[model samples]
Target: MPIIDKEGNFLAVADNVETISNSAAIADVMAQFANAEILGIIFPTHHDGRGYSLTKKLRRAGFNGKLRAIGPLIPDQFSDLIACGFDEIEISDEQFLRQPLVQWLAAKEISQHSYQNNNSTKTSIFQSRRQKIAANRHLNLVRELP
Candidate 1:
């Protein structure tokens, strides 16, 4: 079980999405939006990726709070992790021991383009991809019309 703050925010841990949904009061925090400050989504294990969806859901729900990934995530997944909307990641002690601060910094250098690139000089792949998809869909619809 996770704790829900009086302000209505709670951790979006991998196994806790259901609980959050079931509790109307807790879920209302996200709807209200103003009260949320930090939202934590747990990854549980290195292989589990449910946190990504949780982050996405929070973003789509208009939660501009500090979204954090709390688990034993490796630096290699930082790109996707960030693109999924996490402001920071918190790993377990064992993972920190396995990959030091230097390694994590190096991971940041591995990618210059995330799908949701926010760097001022770069455009998000999502924007370009959306344009192409819409164009393609229009073409298909035109071809089918006559």
Candidate 2:
């Protein structure tokens, strides 16, 4: 399996990674890997969404360590995986060849303007609109200052 970071850069797989099953209880899994430096969540398949929720849960629980989503996830999921707090993705060699690094990078770029407020760096459509309005208001106020 090849590991890719949030920026779609290939990364050497870390050793001694404690990967937990997606089906396991969040609390139990957290308790087991609380002190782990790096953790992996086994996604099982492309259709499994539990991994996303699990990532969010882990982040909310204050697990500030690195997280990897391991499975056959598609390029389209790259952005959401990061938004869900996953630092890296581990995919089979076949999946990597099929999707390629460019595909993963493109998918992430396409989702840069997503309307979700999940990722801090990526601004939502609502935030963009609010910013525009504020800027316009500020301009109007400036014009009136004359």
Candidate 3:
């Protein structure tokens, strides 16, 4: 899951900061990449060194997932965040969504993955058709009642 702050700004909090320092904590999160589907990570502040370390570890570990900085990051920190593997950032929903730079960062380089031919698609189509009929009938009943 994408890590977000209280206001929904993305952030990457070092999982093992108290037990270990930034370097060690970053190593740990990197190691778990195989088992996790981390969409993005967030850094709390520019002053916090942990997030930068974490981003470096993720890149070294082959994590191509999105990285973002949240909280009290300064304008100067933006370049550093990109250097540390942050692809996109959440400044404001409107600005983040509308900005061309943000759009470019958000765009993924498509890769080929294995696909399974499941017959579930046909079953789902039939189920949806049935639901539509039922919904129409219910709507008619409600309208007739008045």
Q: Report each candidate's C-alpha RMSD, comma-separated, in the order given.
A: 10.6, 1.4, 14.2
Q: Model 3: per-residue lDDT, tens digit, 19-99?
A: 123344555665654344333344444477787666667677776654545444443444445545665444544443344
RMSD of 2: 1.4
CA lDDT, candidate 3, residue 63: 65
Error of 2 at 122 (Å): 1.0
Off by over 4 Å in 1: 1-34, 114-122, 125-146
Instruction: Score candidate 1 by TM-score against the native.
Output: 0.58
lDDT of each: 0.60, 0.87, 0.47
Per-residue lDDT for 1-146 in model 2, tens only? Answer: 78999877898655778989987787897788888888999988889899989888888988888999999999899889999899999998888889889999888888778778884478889889999999999999999996
TM-score, structure 3 vs. true? 0.39
Please tell me which predicted candidate would have the highest lDDT against the true structure.
2
Q: Pairs clashing in candidate 2?
A: none
Whole-model lDDT, model 2: 0.87
